[model samples]
Target chain A: MSTSADTVSMGGGNNSPSIRAKVQAFGGFLTNMVLPNIGAFIAWGLLTALFIPSGWMPNEEFAKIVGPAINFLLPLLLAITGGRMVGGQRGAVMGAIGAIGLIVGADIPMFLGAMVIGPLGGLIIKKFDGLLENRIPAGFEMIVNNFSLGILGFLLMLVSFEFIGPVIEAANNGITVAIEALVATGLLPLLSLINEPAKVLFLNNVIDQGIYYPLGMQAAAEQGKSIYFTVASNPGPGLGLLLAFTFFGGKTSKRTAPGAMIIHFLGGIHELYFPYVLMKPLTIVGMIGGGMTGIAVFELFDAGLVAGPSPGSIFAYLGLTPKGSFIGIIAGVLAAAGVTFLITSLILKMDKNTEETEEENLNESIEKSKAMKQEGKEVSAASEQHTTQIEKISFACDAGAGSSAMGATAFRKKLHKKGIEGIEVKHYRIEDVPEDANIVVVHKDLLDRAKIAHSDKEIITIENFLDDPNLHGLLERLENVSK
Target chain B: MLGEHLKGNVRFLESVNSWEEAIRESAAPLLENGSITSKYVDDMIQNVNTNGPYIVVVPEFAMPHAKNENSVEKTGISFLQLQEPVMFPDDKEVKVLFALAAEDSTGHLDLISDLSGVLMEDEARDELKQAKSEKEIIDLINSVE
Candidate 1:
């Protein structure tokens, strides 16, 4: 089942999940917001590539779809999705209303602005809904709900409409000017310094969506292609790094790196190659060198893609490539991979005298990345000092037959009543609480067994499954976090 | 589904000497009907001995069960209402026991859902607790269903 754990930080009151976990969770959220609407981007990219005046098939009628789709439809979808993540269905509606303002206000497409405004609108409605909790009279719930959203959405539309104009004007000047400065300086390849490490730490989304996409879109709007999109997403470095490990790594790493290479290069999932780099941290030098070469090549050729290549796969890169950019794009990817492989192979050969073994690092990095991925699923874990937003709560008992089932069911009912979203309540045996669970709840009597089963976890003990003081505290804490 | 499973599996008892005896007595109906073997009853008691009184899920309520381990022939639920509360580990005073014999985890969920519904609301819990006879218990559980 596609559970909602990956994008939210689901932790209990006591757990202190690592900072890496929080970043992955936020990255997961951003990726979800953009990944779903990528089809729209591709459709627009296809239309633009095929039917624009300079294109091979240049159909005026088909090309008409490109402008409106990127300008209105794509941005609206992003805003709607952003809203739904924060506020649910109603939030989605609010996000669209808010985003329409930015689209009309800005001279350019509002991808970056829509991303910000969508969540803001969702938060606005979610907070408003939270306030309206228990205050609505029973019979007037329908009318109050309708009028409230209608009235709030009307004002939100106006606020965003007016607010977006000034925000876009400032952003236009800021990003466009900064980018032009960077282009003139010829130091774009230095971005690999940030991109390589951030990718391994699960910040690929942040640097891609947060920095490059906006820059690329702006430059592309003017020149039909920009080197910005290819800077961070080039998969060549990962390919080189993994290929090096496949040839020169320890026994386990050598065996594993080949499979990872396939998934990373052709599959375009850069995450597949991270374990290799993490196992041999020094190999990052090779990745950085590869990335720099790729960027330099792209800049030299003045090559770019029509759309951002999500997953960073070679296939996606080729698909999104503008007609004349093929030569340069392919050259950049090959050059980057070749450079990274050469450097990585040299490092692996030299590191034979080091205390660290490639297998050990590989194993630890695999485990660490898994931990980070799980945390990413935990939607919005606020902090340990404050009550964290919980996503998965496991109700554990000796058999997981009767009592735990009853506890999970009752807790689900409470969550439903309180309008808490994204938390998964399920019954599990004391020994079988899933690795993804943010908290484990057990009857106080079984504390010893639970401790023995999961010594690493935070345990919530209760005397009564239905009505316990501790459970009451957790409910209050959850309510506060959601608010 | 729960009411059907619990039809001939309900019992009312005056008392039991120990929590182990309470589970044996509660599961007696399921055992006699071939839903589970005597080993299932012993394993349910052994579960508490090893894990303590966690089976006493709420005040005055306990659900005794263990891994089927090939001891269960069919899934079934049996309820027993003790006239006087029996002392369990951790000094839990339990007056009701729901001895579960599940063939597998997912198969017995309908019955579990019915039981949760019965216990979730204060009014329904009080109603089930006040029930006197086997028919009354079955009727109360069914009402929630």
Candidate 2:
């Protein structure tokens, strides 16, 4: 049931196939370039996790490992990789040179900034290479190439320092101001409200890579660890929800929740549990409660991480924890789990009838969808003002497969039973909704997210894919337009 | 558990022209057994065509099925193995097809879960792929229990 929703960001255009292709190409580049280096990132995570001052190796010699790795080597390695992706060996060197400029000139990790500058440096070098392709004399090629590269490296370093460096610093400062205000107002835990929902919406990258990474790098550079790194990356809330579902859920939950828990908690793909929460929007309170609990304990114990854990794995969590603060982190996670379990159990119990209604709605929608084929004549009469017809209907979920795929199957059968032909129906991950999709169907909980991602597209929200009356209404609308 | 229904329902075909042909050939046994109507087979094929290949659960496996809409007379599963795999447009190739017809969405989940459990075991899957007779496939399903 694995769906391709987590990574694909669709263009919000019915006519813009070019825009869709560009978005897909960029998404592919980002995923291919960055995903392979996760091992390196995890290794860096391990180093900072275990060798920091409060870690297993508290010796001064081991503590020395944290500085150069986080501040220089890791970011430099990432830049080299990104540059190699965009250009070749020469671009890799310029990318590293550009990153080094940022590393030396700034107080933060500079890794996030490197991702952008590295590609830019690589592109510049590639352009230079292209310009000089046949212009250099054969005899003086080596000399010319070496001297020009040195000059280019120096120029890129200047560009990183004099230009991009200040912009990054300013962005970091602005985020810091917002965070400091929250902390100053004694509302740090309130971040959980925003963070948990955003994470479920698959906006973890925006919050982590876009905002927290720079701040965390700066914080880690100053201190041994940064709490900024741990704020949203913690898996405790997700773990709590999954645990609750496994123990106290319905039949489907009991069957699937355990597998999801292992993948989510240990494997560190928190997106696995998002559908469980989406199935019941009321359970978001559990997530909020768990998040608040974890953050509260982190603050109370002053527990922090040497670097941001990408997957938020427990091993990564412990690896980054300061010496005595390990217990605090554990306590925070357990407390979050306990609170979430209690809230989720209650919500699940209360929503039993609502869940039943959802199932009924699904069956009803199927019946109505089938009825549309027989009632095609009635639809054509209503077509006078309806010109915007939906050519394609796509069902989208967290990963795009489990619920949405099944829903699409049921819907398709309904259409076929009614003798409705040629209308395309497909399923995708919410992020990967195809540009041509006229109506994007998503679980009700993801309505806000679908809107944010594709504001111009017509979206249909259902409590669950099985029982949505909206699908029938949408088909009626489509029929009117089709006529 | 699935072995009881697999008696006289399992077949290993030499080849097929397309995935739709493979699906129809797989479901033929169930249709003969009165487990499903011909409409059910058409609906299942239509599902695969419209929704891409979500049915191809594993590298070389697919379970082609559709939701019940008076097309299913009973819950049944027919197993077929092709000598050469049929390729779907999505790059998923299916050497084995499990044509499932359920009375309702939740009706045959337990059987599906049990079947998935067996399919996931490499040893069981390898045995099923190579088995020439129905008894061997039944024995493998029994061993899973």
Candidate topping TM-score: 1
- Measured against the true chain A, the candidates' chain A TM-scores are 0.78, 0.64
Q: What is the lDDT of residue A403 in candidate 1?
A: 80
Model 2 misplaced regions, further than 4 Å = A1-57, A130-148, A354-483, B1-145
TM-score of 1: 0.64
lDDT of model 1, residue A382: 51
**Which DockQ values do the candidates obtain, in the order shown?**
0.47, 0.02
Provide the RMSD of all predictions against the true structure, rounded to 1 decimal: 12.7, 24.6
> Candidate 1, residues A139-236: lDDT per residue as tens digits?
99899988888898888778777886568668767977876687779987888887887787677897797678766766665566678889899999
Clashing pairs in 2: A3-A399, A5-A429, A8-A431, A49-A319, A54-A323, A362-A466, A362-A467
**Top candidate by lDDT:** 1
Clashes of 1: 11
lDDT of 2 by residue, B1-145 (tens): 6778777889999899998899999999999989999998998888766655656655677778776779889888889998888897566678988788878655565566556656656787678778888888888888896
lDDT on C-alpha atoms for all candidate structures = 0.80, 0.70
Give one digit per residue, the lDDT tens place, for model 1 in B17-56: 9988899999999999999999999998898888777777
**Model 2, C-alpha of B30: deviation from truth (Å):** 73
